[model samples]
Target: MEKYDYEQLVICQDKESGLKAIIAIHDTTLGPALGGTRMWTYASEGAAIEDALRLAKGMTYKNAAAGLNLGGGKTVIIGDPKKDKNEAMFRAFGRYIQGLNGRYITAEDVGTTVEDMDIIHEETNYVAGISPAFGSSGNPSPVTAYGVYKGIKASAKEVFGTDILAGKKVAIQGVGSVAYTLCEYLHDEGAQLIVTDINEEAVQRAVDAFGARAVGLDEIYSVDCDIYAPCALGATLNDQTIPKLNAKIVAGAANNQLELDKHGDLLHQKGILYAPDFVINAGGVINIADELNGYNRERAMKHVDKIYDNLETVFAISKRDNIPTYIAAERMAEERIASLRNSRSTFLQNEHHVISRR
Candidate 1:
């Protein structure tokens, strides 16, 4: 807890339902902690706790960078989403969240689905990403893709002096739901796509739909293109792949794109403009956050579109400080959080003064 400055960690278990979960709350200065519940088959309990804590901290930065009024938290359920899932497990988990009295909110994540979120919603009102029938935002993939698309254009504007993607070759490293939707946006803008994925069917879909050229997973990094989009997994922009990149711009929906902070510095030295992952991929969280205000697609999208301006700010900071974009992104989030903390402290002091006068 001291290492990460975590606020709280709750371990929940229900033997009858075979539910073992860990909820990590990283920060709550802005508001209630909000993040997704990820159900996965972990190697051990320690691994699950670590993952929850790390993800919770990431959500803190992602939410704050996106200008959301929420803090950061994450929940991890240790089990295979394919085989161990039961309504009883999620219901019990939801009860745990309810016991927190709205300190934490959960939505669907990696191994969880909307159906799972719907089940949890039955037990607690502190949930989002439920079915549209529940007056909640359904799927956040498309909105996330839109935000990434906008962020890519912002990165392009910074590096190439133009945001137009027409005729620019972009090597996309994944064709997952979010990346596939992003491809649609890029294709519509007349960008040439080079796509790769471990899933053959997904790659074929992109190739058929967008005329994207399919490449091997290992070959994607070295592909000659104007931009490289690592949409598959985190930490792909490490030493080996960084040396092979031919693109001038690096932008995608993947989290933790850099394996280490030094790699971000390396990119800076190499003159590659990078759009920070959390800021660029905040659309999903931003979408679910709108549920707190009574879900409105129009309003939510307008907020997600601000990702462009957010990246522009990060780039400006990078230029002003002569630092890496990743560092600049964290600086932006930290400044916002610090400003809010200072304002809240003043407000409390004034309130105490007024009471003392009374």
Candidate 2:
């Protein structure tokens, strides 16, 4: 907890359901912690806890950067989603969330689904991304993709002095659901696309739909392009790959694109305008957060569109502070949280004074 300044960490278990999970709350200065629950077959208990803590901290920054009145938390179930899932397990998990008394809110994430969230909802009203019938926001991928698209445009404007994507070459590192939708938007803008994926079918789909050129997985990093979008996995911007990048900008849907803080610094040194992953990929969280206020699609979309403006702000801070964009993003979030923390402290002191007078 001291390493990351975590707020809380809970270990939950249910023998009957074979449920073993870790919930980590990293911050709540802005508001209650909101993040998704991920189920994975972690190698060890410690690994699961570490993942939960790291992800929770990332959510704190992601939420604050997106301008959401929420903090960061995350849950990790130590099991295989494919073979270990059961209704009883999810209900048990939900009960654990209920025990938090609204300090942490969970939704669907990798190895989990809306159905799992719905099951969790049975035990706690604190869950988001449940079925739309329950007034929840459905699949956040499209909204996330839209935000990345807008972020890319903002980065383009910063680098090329215009946001027009027509005739620009883009290398997309994934053709998954979010990246596929992002391709549609970029294709419509006449951006030339070079794509790659581990799944040939997915790659073929992008090729057929967007007329994208398919390349080998390793070939993606060296592709000649104006922008490189790493939409697949995290840490693609490490020491090995950074030197191979031929793009002028890095913007995508992946979380934790930089393997380490120094890699972000390396990108900055190379003059690559990187749209910080947390800031650009905040649309999904922004989409689900709207559920707190009765789930308005238009309102959520308008909020997602602000990703462009958010990136603009990050860039401005980068220039003003002469720091990497990643550092600037962190500064922005920290400043917001610090301001709110001060105001809340004053409000509480004033309330205490009134009570003391009475």
Candidate 3:
């Protein structure tokens, strides 16, 4: 197994339930690692391991940039979410999380739901995004969308010298839970929308609701628009797609959007202002983190809204340092973690490692 300097990579199995999962803890410098758990039917173990490691590292950056006193980790279950989910499967998974004793907290992610989180919560207190009945935040997609919207505006300010999205042509590459809400915001702001998705129903919904023009999936990258929002998946800004993008600003709710460090350089050289995915898409985690503080929606959203200012800070650092925005964001996060690690060296007294007990 290849480890990328991650603090821990735990493989879990529940043979009776045919459950095979991997939980990757990237760092716990500032606090216990916190991130979501995803279930996917990967082609190979290597692919699943890669996803877990990458997502865990992304969460570390996401939490750090969000200014949360938390570290980064992620969990992945290798299976078809639609067919393989069951109470036993998740309970078994949760047992493994409990074994960590709060070193890694898990929540909902792609292929998982609040119900799944509720199941996990049954076995461990180190779970977020549970049902509101459990006094935890539910469904982080809308807040994630709001943060992405704010980031889009920030990118507009950087590239066009104005944050107004009105009269702007924006191409959104996915009409998922997050992007759909994002479209509503853009439409209300008077922006013309061009959208694409694999699901015909989702595409039709956006077209009917927001008057967004629907495009083929492949055509989304080539759409002539002011901003390109990739809400589907990560690494969409790789070598092949970067040359096809016509948007001046690239911002969306995907994690690890850059396929590689050099791809960010490619976007920079193309004069496309790219919002760091971890910074712009920190809303979901930010919203979930509020559960640790007593689940206040207003307070959580207030923090998510700060993504606009944080992204602006990243842009400033990018220009000042003459580096890619992604690098600038990483530098900003690393600096914060480094400084805080130096200043705060004491361990929490709690055995469960509660992040924000109120």
lDDT string for model 1 (1-358, tens) is 9987899999999999999999999999889999999999999999999989988999999999999999999999999999999999999999999999999999998889999999999999999999999999998999999999999999889988999999999999999999999999999999999999999999999999999999999999999999999998789999899999999999999987999899999999999999999999999999999999999999999999999999999999999999999999999998999999999999999999999999
| Descending-lDDT candidate ranking | 2, 1, 3
Each model's number of backbone clashes? 0, 0, 0
lDDT tens digits by residue: candidate 2, 46-159: 999989998999999999999999999999999999999999999999999999999999998888999999999999999999999999997888889999999999999999
Q: Report the lDDT of model 2 for residue 235.
A: 92
lDDT of every predicted structure (CA atoms): 0.95, 0.96, 0.92
- Looking at model 1, the pairs that clash are none
User: Worst lDDT window (10 residues) for model 3?
Assistant: 344-353
lDDT score, residue 218, model 1? 96
